[model samples]
Target chain A: MQRPYNFSAGPAAMPVEVLQQAAAEMLDWHGSGMSVMEMSHRGKEFMSIIETAEADLRELLAVPPNFRILFMQGGGLGENAIVPLNLSRGGVVDFVVTGSWSQKSFKEARKFCDPHLAASNEADCHTRLPAPGSWQLSPDAQYVHLCSNETIHGVELHELPDLKALGSNAPLVIDFSSHVASRTVDWRRVGLAFGGAQKNLGPAGVTLVVVREDLLGHALSICPSAFDYKTVADNGSMYNTPPTYGIYMAGLTFQWLKRQSEGNLRGIAAMEHRNMAKAELLYGFIDQSSFYVNKVATDCRSRMNVPFFLRDESRNEAFLAGAKAAGLLQLKGHKSVGGMRASLYNAMPLEGVQALVAYMRDFEQKLA
Target chain B: MQRPYNFSAGPAAMPVEVLQQAAAEMLDWHGSGMSVMEMSHRGKEFMSIIETAEADLRELLAVPPNFRILFMQGGGLGENAIVPLNLSRGGVVDFVVTGSWSQKSFKEARKFCDPHLAASNEADCHTRLPAPGSWQLSPDAQYVHLCSNETIHGVELHELPDLKALGSNAPLVIDFSSHVASRTVDWRRVGLAFGGAQKNLGPAGVTLVVVREDLLGHALSICPSAFDYKTVADNGSMYNTPPTYGIYMAGLTFQWLKRQSEGNLRGIAAMEHRNMAKAELLYGFIDQSSFYVNKVATDCRSRMNVPFFLRDESRNEAFLAGAKAAGLLQLKGHKSVGGMRASLYNAMPLEGVQALVAYMRDFEQKLA
Candidate 1:
């Protein structure tokens, strides 16, 4: 049976194989006579599960040994507050507002620190990226934060900026929620990277944080102990029951990513290659058609979430109904941006994008 | 095929039926063609899920209309800081420390508020409850906090204290993580009740917060917006992505609880009767035996978690091994307290506890 290709921004689709494996092991995980959800966090079984998950995630991301991987709760919005609480230290912080997510982060940080907007693409309607060289970095800023990929506006930073070259000593923090594990990350340029697992990882309950060791112990006194980077690292993310089942599912996804192969490339490399191909196919079709147009600049277009609009806005409902009939689901754009969005995350195959393009062409022909 | 009887304290055993239903629906839920984990939290499918779960839980607990049930993350320990951040108003808060859980709560809250120890059972090594009358009610205290059931020390408050009756009008905040849904709560006496769903509800990621409507919005500026009670309540727990799959599993558990029957009783009342019977059988055996003993006072003993010790310390390993071989699992006590614990949660049938008692008897006789 063919499954529908889901296009929701997030809590998004997961690998079919992972879902099947989890179903098979739902009652008894490896003869333990308990589901993964039923095992105690401190039990040897769950300990192994979390340990393996951390190890696999580290391997997939090529996370440096100096970085600690902590599994936590609360999505990106929660981290918007938690980040400032831990890193802000009631001092000045720098932000590069590229889209809706960074705008939120900027607003939330005001509660904990002096947040300054270093650069913004709002003047360009978030269709282009603000040049890193143009950013006015604070000399004593604790960290410079940005969303690596904006799910809403379909804009992505293909390469991270080197803060040292930009004359800033502050560490770079990236909210990688939308595109983590979809490609390789340059950890050398990062002080911390956090993402909600719902988008590209596994489920909605868990948030993954990879922070540098030196950046760990500086959490402000007001930070919740469970969210204190130093405390979470010290307890191995077990400081407050670390979303056991979500961690388990993320572990499965990491294993799935490891097994992915494309020609000579494998693992994250293979995924990146496949993602590029899928993005190219969909975006190419949209750009060539007069009926469909993506507003984001070509150089900064997101390789994961592709947002486009129909020239004939009157056919929005009809397009969605036809898409659903063709098993292309959740194609509606965010309310704030009225159009259509197709998020091609790690789980979305090349064929799914092909099917979407095919459906779009067929719909346009019918209208003609 | 026989399944092992698991006694893990939290992240404990779920009803086999719930697990089976979750497994069967793992790939597609109600013809939605998407796993619960894959559905968007804002989508109609997940909205229905969270709504139904809240309604069912409220119905089961007979929750007053004035109380808002907020599905959150970060567990009970997370609530330690969250509770004070939202309610303490940076002023004095009183605590009645009964065991290890409440002790942790007291320590974490000091970071956010002026925490006063109104009463403590630590002098008795958490074996008994401090009488409500003996509590030093603070005239200007924001709220008085206590753990309804201490999972580690096996101490429980059978009845919630009325602060007004105790000559204090401060709201009573109870951490009922271990005993929620196991028995009915007197909402009239509670200002707020919070619990990690891992214990009696479902999984670890989702924390259930049933708060009085009037207590909705007093979050400290430092509180993470995702965790602010008012922000969460106003957004219907969608201020951030909620633990979607956990909420769904909790919904299944609520249904399972509703279907429970014991003699003439039904639902939570039925589970309470069965829980009482299970506790009596196990505690009766331990109290009557020469080889085993429970240290908690009889009047305050936990019906959910019963911790006991082997009279002969040398037989601890043997007892645990034998229990495992006899299809009994996770009977080891928390490391802080050296002994054994058999948590008879809502999922543990009366037969599981009976089997545990039978195994203890046979082990004791063999040693003799």
Candidate 2:
């Protein structure tokens, strides 16, 4: 079967190996005479699947014991409400809008709390993160919120802000939707991080919420039990019936991540290395070509999602068609910002980036 | 591979054929060169998947043009809060609680509005639905709610009540989680019908909401945009990135249902016939046996979930083990209501029921 390199910014590509393994096990998961989808979430069979997935994820991210990992639904947008409901304490909340995602989060939080804009890059058309030092954090803020990566605008925070260093005692909350699992997270600086799994993990429904334990019990009285962090943690994320099939696929993907090897390093260390290589390959090609340009500032550009536009703006359709012919898919950018975006997540191999670069170079030559 | 028949209420069993097909398509769906999980929700490929799934569901349920179909996250419990937030309009709401789910809905709705329990079976341990004539629905009730099938108590409303006939023009909302696609729905009487796909359709994470056009714009000011039906409906359920993989699987299951035939009867008609036969075979065996008892009222017993108690409660372990050995699995009832529960949803075939019956008889004979 002719398979293409997919670079869509989420519900994005997953490891092909993970999919193959899942397919092989779909009829009977590990010889249990039931598909993982068919097994009870409470049954030992499914419990094992969940446990391993969580454990592998913990190891990959080096998650601290004081934090809880929750598999949730409703993606990052859902969490815009859920985060404030759980953390805002119905008081003041601080937000730093780096791009489209945090802007959305800030707007959503206004419904639940007294949201104060700590910083914003809206004037710059969301092409870069506002420097952490410039954020005007609220002294009474329940938590300080920011987007670590904006999938739509291709802006990323290479290093998370230290809220304590910035004279804010409020826990730092980051919407890390686009780049989770692609690189290491510094839990010391993070009180909570959430992302939709569609980007770097598995699917749309299974969202990952990693929050510090101390921040768990403060959900608003208006919060639904299913969306309440304390209830979900206490129930082992089964306060409501979870997205079981998505969890299963994610578990397989986790196992695949653990088994990945690159020379002396393995697992996420290898993943980080590979992601760096893929990002460099694509970004290098873009920088070298006069026919293409990426708009993000150099210091904070996302390594996962790279948005570029053709120099000849009218040739966008032709570029996309040529890329499609070369077995490259989903080159379309966010509609709000008309361009091409190549999202090279943890699942995108260096080889896939090589193929993408090769296609870009060929297309540029034809256009010239 | 050893595979056990799963019978959990929701997040329940999936058809083996569907699982096999999903597995086969997992790596590269229809040679698109990406798993369904990997496709961008907004791309042409995934839009096709979403549209096809929606169309298949619309066809299977014969949902009218005036009704909007929303694919959402959150299970029935989340909907408990979301329903009131969207439909309560700060007015009084009425509930007819025959079982656990509706009771939970009522309690949650109390947080948002003045929810009056119009009718209840708590006095009777929820064995039957309260008669419509006995319901004291509020004159100013914004909406009247009911659980069409209570998964835990195994009680079902075989025919829905007409609220207008009961002197209330309030819309009727039904939670059809356990038996959504197992039988036909009378859309004429239902202003909204919400269900989690885990029971009879596909997996958890995908909740189906069919709401009439009139109920579209009544969301409370504080309702989260993600949970607002009007926002969801207006965006064609793309207000947020939908549970893409779950919808795809549910769509495939819908297609499977469409192709189903038992001597020329197809789709919901065939499912109804099969469901009746399966329910009868198990219930008939329980009725005749001295070692088994089902306490639900005959008129209101759920065809999908059969809760039965072994005459000798001490032999429950032996019964489950013996049943497992005989390839009949997950017959254990819910912990809240102890005993064995055989959830014969749309996916459970007549052969599975026959095997369960034969196993029951064998176990009972051994006891004798």
Whole-model Cα lDDT of every candidate shown, in order: 0.95, 0.89
TM-scores vs. true structure, each candidate: 0.99, 0.98
Over A63-123, each residue of candidate 1 has an lDDT whose tens digit, in order, gives 9999999999888998998998889889999999999999999999999999999999999
Report fnat, model 2. 0.79
TM-score of chain A of 2: 0.98
Which candidate achieves the best DockQ against the true structure? 1
User: What tens digits encode model 1's per-residue C-alpha lDDT throughout B1-368?
Assistant: 78999999989999999999999999999988899998988889999999999999999999999999999999998999999999999999999999999999999998999999999999999999999999998999999999999999999999999899998888999999999988989998999999999989998899999999988788888888999999999999999999999999999999999999988999999999999999999999999999999999999999999999998888999999999999999999999998999999999998899899999999999988
Window of ten residues with lowest summed lDDT in model 2 chain B: B1-10
What local lDDT does model 1 show for residue A92? Answer: 96
Candidate 2 clash pair list = A33-B2, A33-B3, A33-B4
Q: At residue A242, what lDDT does model 2 achieve?
A: 86
Cα lDDT for residue B228, candidate 1: 95
